[model samples]
Target: MPSVNRLLHPSEAAKRLGVSAKALRLYEQRGLVEPGRTEAGWRAYGQEEMDRAAEIVALRALGLSLAQVKRVLEGDSQGLEPTLAAHQAALEAQLRQLARTVEKVRGLRSDLMQGRAPTVDELMNLQAPLREVRVAFELPWPWGGELFELRDIRSLNYIIGPLGSGKTRLAHSLAEALPNAAMLALERLEDDGVTAAKSRMDSDPILKSRVDEAISWLVEDGANSSDALVVLLAGLEADGPDALVVDMIEQGLDHATQEALIAWLRRRGANARPLFMLTRSCAILDLSAVGPDETIILCPANHSPPMQVAPYPGAPGYEAVATCLASPEVRARTAGVVAWRPSSGRLQSLTP
Candidate 1:
């Protein structure tokens, strides 16, 4: 039996809690949990700290923000009700899916007992939810018309390349090729765009609420609200499109805003709508944060066909993707430097 007052090291405590040591460190940083320090300065989690940490983890798993968790931990129950209701609804949805799976299995078993054999395809269709959505289309201009096949389109897909790499054209082509997809162009930041975005948000109360919640969460994560961001996010959170392709998703945002925005998007989970974001900011395209439900598409500088890059250090195109991305500060510094493509006879900058 474990000692009631025994203290465990950070790694041991994290293992016991089914979380990572980094998560515990985050909890500590947020003042959500306070662990003791050993004589050698190593962190130690006692029973009290472990209980508190577990509560924080549970609250986070229920979709509550760190700020919301803090408020609930402070004995304020107002925010808890809505979060609990959301969690309950999610669980209910999962239960319904599970029920359908059980029924399918029972039916299959009954048929087997009756000497009726099911086909392999029928058995495979039972796990339809786990299947990936694949898309194939012909590549657009700047490259010879080549076939582009994208398999297992994930929740978050990043399209990245240097200027003049035809990334924008690729994004547009994807939006055109994919079913129920639309591209949110940079013109959305033009004059009167915010008004149009506001109108759309006003037309859909649920979408507006979701956007508001996301904005609040981003704000808590150190993001500053802007008309540009609001316009972009309204489209992203809107319900009509099955997928969205965004050009320069980190445009007009500072480093903190970019980081917070990406973090917020990542937290939306694997079931969220597929999003194709064109970004060159390291903050927006953090390779380390790429999950199984996220994919990176890199358009090589040499005009080779765009290929999906695995989120590992040594993967082909992985280094290219990393090279294309810059720290938000670096991106800001070089934002005005345009690539010069000289026309025939005389050196002239290419214009849209």
Candidate 2:
């Protein structure tokens, strides 16, 4: 008898589900969904498995924890109340914003009827709220003063380059140029500094609550708890600064942690503020998993001006960007390894 076939592979399932293959692995780890093993021992998602995974993904979209999702799946409705309330509040806020936008549109139409035309900027802003948000500056030290201007910045952006490529300077320049933006570098390593940071969190219940929730989610998603994770989450959950530029986002994270962290960062909702993260870890900057709302900026090794790199192959700077990325395991192996910088400020080192 012929065997019945036609189950999707993890990558195909992930593509259809609008999530990363890593996410499906995490879901399986959390006992959320189980895919079938093929005759060759490969995981295959049949219809039943896909349906279950889809339910878990939907619950996650509603901001439900994996544990909470399991509870709901097991016929326990208790965890739904708070999540639904928060979802309702977010929807209501969006409704209010839409009402204001409608009022603006009506006024614009009235002006048109009265023979008054709206400016291009006004029309663009009306059509796309974020269109007016722009970043413009000159390329910094490593390159000559080349003008750079970016409009409609996405929520998650990556700045990647080889060592001594001056990605750090570019990140700092971005933070300085963006209005109401802040930079969180990897400089808080001293014992005293860690203690002080924890003390601040312990003192502020509200801040502590936000940080704790973020930590719990990351931990549940297979990330290891560490001082580095805590510091990053504190900045991410803090209630100030419209945008953030993070230096070396995967600095102290392990392989699993880096995978989980990037997955979590990608799940930030549509209204999430812009984030410009500098990273070379392949896990953190997985070209395959990049979505429409993410952008990649590559700093060339030849000290040329930084330019945006498309996720696809053959695009300008795509190979350079790809060559710069290393798996988290490889990166960890090379941790604390540095190349000597020469008089020209260019360091000689192969990609990690």
What TM-score does each of the candidates earn?
Answer: 0.81, 0.87
Name the candidate that leads on TM-score: 2
Q: Candidate 1 — which residues are off by over 4 angstroms?
A: 1-57, 130-132, 340-352
Across residues 1-352, which tens digit of lDDT does each residue of candidate 2 receive? 1122579999988888888897798789888999999999999998888888889988888877677788889999984776688788878877877887898899999999999999997786676743235899998898788998788688899999999898999999999999999888777555665676688788888888988877777776677999988888877877788999998899888988887787677666556789999998999998877888899999899988888988988999999999999998898898789976565434434434
Error of 1 at 208 (Å): 2.8
Cα lDDT tens digits, model 1, 255-347, are 878877876786666767899999999888877657678999999998899999998789999899988989888887888798785666454
lDDT for predicted candidate 1 compared with the true structure: 0.84
Backbone collisions counted per model: 0, 0
